[model samples]
Target: MSFDIGNPSYGLVFWTLIAFLLLLVLLRKFAWKPIIQALNERETSIENALASAEKAKEEMARLSNENEQLLKQARVERDTILKEAKELKDQIVTDAKVQAQTEGAKLIEQAKKEIDDQKKRAMAEVKNQVSSLAIDIARTVLQKEFEDNKKQEALVADLLKDVKLN
Candidate 1:
């Protein structure tokens, strides 16, 4: 028998159909089941990785917010400390000024008292010198008057006449 190019025999067609069906059954059992199972496992792993990435992103956002709040709190604390330091500095300056003024006033008063004391001492000394000079002048005049015998007799007679019995 001669083989035809376009038309096949009935026996050959029947055998080809049986062989195709057998190949499909063998591929399903050996390759198709494992391939489908592997694809399902790959899909599940991809989903788990996406979930983990989302969780990490949320955690980073929360951390950023916490850090900002902490920075703001630190700034507030720093400002408070600076304000207290400024107030303390001003108070110290004011106290120093007051103390200096008080000391200056005390020194002025002390100086005035010292001057008054010196002036009083000087006046006392002048009065003593004047009294001593007056006594010396009176003694010199008496000595001159007593040197003349006739004046001395006349002075004695005047002094005796002025002495009267009370």
Candidate 2:
């Protein structure tokens, strides 16, 4: 433990400088190449990892866009189907209304025809009854008039005069 900072030994200093130079030369020849190669390999691996991350980000963005497009297509198809169903519903309602009106009109026409037929039959029956009553009244009046001979003879003379005048 004799540390003399002021009184240094020249021979020891000279040997220490030589040993340091030798160590520097040996490290440069042996350790520096391996260390530099390892650093370069680490830098290349980092670059490859960064590139893979960027590619994955791009792929995620592309998939998100595809999913958005699919959702939009599905919405459009749903709207189209709903619109078609509405149109079909309207068409069916219109067809049903038209059919009902046509049926009502046909029934009305049939009822009118039936009423006309019944009116004509009633009028014909009334005319036949009136004609038969008139004939019966005329036969009864002629029977009463023809009962007495003298009166019947006088009536015959008058009917002959009336016929001759006609």
Q: lDDT of each model, Cα atoms only? A: 0.94, 0.94
lDDT at 30, model 1: 93
Candidate 1 off by > 4 Å: 1-20, 141-166
lDDT of 1 by residue, 1-166 (tens): 8999698899988999999999999999998999999999999999999999999999999999999999999999999999999999999999999999999999999999999999999999998998889989989998998899999999889999999988
Q: List the residue pairs that clash in candidate 1.
A: none
Q: Model 1 TM-score?
A: 0.69
Q: Give me candidate 2's TM-score against the actual structure.
A: 0.70
lDDT by residue for model 2 (85-157), tens: 9999999999999999999999999999999999989999988999899889988988887887888999888
Of candidate 1, the 10-residue stretch with the lowest lDDT total is 5-14
In model 2, the worst 10-residue window by lDDT is 157-166
Error of 1 at 162 (Å): 11
- What are the models' TM-scores? 0.69, 0.70
